[model samples]
Target chain A: MTRFGRMWVMTGLLLGLAMPAGPARAQEHAPAAAAQAGGHEIDIQHHIGDSHEIEIPFVGIYELPRFAPIHVGGLVIDLSPTKHLVFMLLSALIVALVFVLSARSIAGAQARGRPATGFAGAMEATTLWIRQEVILPTIGPHGDKFVPYLLTLFFFILAMNLFGLVPGGATATGNITVTAALAIIAFLVIEVTGMRTLGPKGYLGTIFYRPHGLPGGPGGAVLKVVLLAVLTPIELIGKLAKPFALAVRLFANMTSGHVLVLALIGLTFLFQSYTVGLGASVLATGVLLLELFVAFLQAYVFTLLTSVFIGLMREAH
Target chain B: MVHALMLALQEEHTSGPLTVEGGLMLWTVFIFILLLLVLKRFAWPAILGAVEAREQALEQQLAEAERSRTEAAALLAEHKRLVADAKGQAHGIIVDARQLAEKERAAAMEKTKQEQQEFLARARREIDVERDRAIADLRREAVDLSLAAASKLIGERVGTDTDRKLVMDYLATLDGGR
Candidate 1:
């Protein structure tokens, strides 16, 4: 290991040794400290997971507005907003506001025959880069129509991912339901694009597993049936697996990073030692930086994969 | 179907990491759809269209510039050719003028030489005619004087055709002998 790596390992070992020894002394303080530790333990999960309350920094936790469950026949569904839902709305609002303002600024600049400036310039560059690099290249030439949808997905997910790093914000993208919904949209777009590009007969070719150049006899007919029977289920699974992977990958990556950061901070309270708290703070800060990187990475991966899947479906063999 | 989906959602919502809140999904779908519609309508066209238009304008300007450059090159070549043609025409004019001047000078010299030769020939012919006339006159006068003197010496009128014939015959014999 390099010097920095060795030093980090040594510091980790020292913290590991001191953490267990410090808790014994922490027990000498009071029962109230133990109660606080239990509270911190519970807070870690609630902090990363979706809940009914929003925790504002320097403000007490506030319960979200509750609504009566919708009932249809024998079914009851809770439609009240939760913490993640509130943040999701915030992300959407931010995305809409920024893009709209950028649109205006860009339009004005274009009218004046000048280039875009300031935040508007940055937004334009990002939009162009995403369209030219991510969407058009992966989704091919006809992907122009899909630019707005994919751009929205990229920015919205990115906004949600970054919001999770804020002191009192929740990551909507970390939720399975949220990722799954986005995935479902992507799945629909991909499949529908395939259906439209390849007519009904052509689209069926993807699922039916018809091979070219089969023999010209009864043996060929029997072989064709056997191949269809064997390959159809596999083709169906392949189609479904794309969206499933997109949803689970985004959800897992976003959630895991938050869990690690929360768990690290929770350790400071659990040990009840100033040294452990300091160590945990440093470690948590590092992990938070990694989480920040993960946020953008996950967003890009989700968008790229979605575009690739759409392209693949459009050009299915 | 609604009951079954609700049951599954409820079960997952209370469960561990794979919690599926139906409300969150509904909210996501609602927000995404709305955002897509609004942004697509208000934002994408203006921004994307402007950029594409700017790119097209740049390409057109570049093409026009290239065309003008090519036209200028062709015009320059034509101008150079015209200059060279004018220079060649001027050279041809000078050569023709020199040749005409040389021909005229040679013709004038030939005409002057011919005139001098003709004058010399005429002068020689006139001189010969004058000499012949003077000789004839001298001969006639000699004959007349000889006849007069003979007639005076003889103291007789012998001035007739016979005396002229005798003198003419004597002159012919003298010319033949000389």
Candidate 2:
């Protein structure tokens, strides 16, 4: 293995061990044991309730806040920072590293053996499959052009989702901010691709022009205009709704999976039974596996849908 | 089913509204946009171009292989044709050799028959000449015998003139008959 490959493997191993075991150990030891062991618990007191936080030496702080939030205009809004951003960055880095390594393998003049292997190969196969099977088919002639965007989105979302499943890791996608940002990016790409394909005037005109099958000229034009005006907003609303939908879909999936696992785990604590605890732990672990699948699934779905939406937008009316 | 899933998701997120600070939201948007632009410019084009180049290279290799196969087939066919022609020429040579041998044998037989006929004719001519000489000798011997007998028949003191007259008479009669 190259030095880079060895480093990634080490990093993956460290992350694999650190992410789950650290949280589990903290949960087991309790505040008293942790203090006895000379471990300090950084107490992050918030508006809702007091929660225990953990701090890594070089890494940022970690905490899980309560469900309650600050209300504005009858809307309860969450303002606390979740571990979601850290996971998001980590996932992005992982994806970038994998692609960079794969790209390097291809760029090298003398590449031996299989082109795809380890994490890099797996990622390449997935991206190629999506580009060929999903994006190109949906997008048509220029479909290949959008491959990078779709691939990046898929990996980025996937990494974040997987990270969330780790015990101490938070779901960045669960936060509206992260999902909304991703959605906006999709929205921009779709619009830009559409604008580039259909000139700006043509794109705008599509919103107002309705083809007429009926015969009274002025009346037809008027009726068409009125119908188009109504449809335009609806179309616009649908466009807005897509990214919102994407964000919510991913956020909800990650959050629900976490919540379910947490609830299952909490049952043992509530009942104070060793058998129940063990059973719940087993169930939670199974759910965690399912969560892993969902992480990848949601990421794929989000990227695929975005590509499809962009493809549709780029089409001639 | 999709609707139900969406509804469930909504219900789960309904617990709190996430209010991101405007500045952070703006910054997030800017960073994401920058990321997309940078990716589009730098990473994406390179990656896509590489993939395309790889595909083209594979296609070119396939075409080249096909061309080589066709050329090989053509060469094989030419070789086979040349071999067939050589075989045909060999057959022709064998046929020509047999015909020439037959002609030469006929000429030799004709020459041998002519020589034998010439020898037979020469031998026949020599036998005819020898037979003629023998006939002449026999005739001469007969004539001598006749003359002696005649002389003995006549007495010793008999007039030669009378015997000569007889012989002359015989000669005259022979001449008159001729």
Docking class of 2: incorrect
Among residues 3 or more apart in sequence or in different chains, the pairs in candidate 2 whose N, CA or C atoms overlap within 3 Å are A84-A172
Query: Candidate 1 at A315: error in angstroms?
Result: 2.1
Cα displacement (angstroms), candidate 1, residue A78, comes to 1.9
Tens digits of per-residue lDDT for model 1, A1-317: 24522443444445334432112112222133335443334233444568787766435568988899888677666789888889999999999999999999999999999889999999999999999999999998788998999999999999999888765677889889999999999999998999999999889988887778999799999999999999999999998999999999999998887666545544655565557766765776667677788889998999999999989888899
RMSD of each: 9.1, 10.0
Leading candidate by TM-score: 1
List, residue by residue over B68-158, the lDDT tens digit for candidate 2.
Answer: 9999999999999999999999999998998988988998988888888888888888888887677556545544455567666763443
**Candidate 2: segments with Cα more than 4 A from true spot:** A1-82, A97-134, A209-234, B1-24, B37-57, B106-178
Root mean square deviation (Cα) for candidate 1: 9.1
The candidate that wins on DockQ is 1
Q: In model 1, what is the error at residue A187, expressed in angstroms? A: 0.6
TM-scores of the models, in the order given: 0.74, 0.66
Once superposed on the true structure, which residue ranges of model 1 sit more than 4 Å away at CA?
A1-43, A71-76, A264-286, B1-16, B101-178
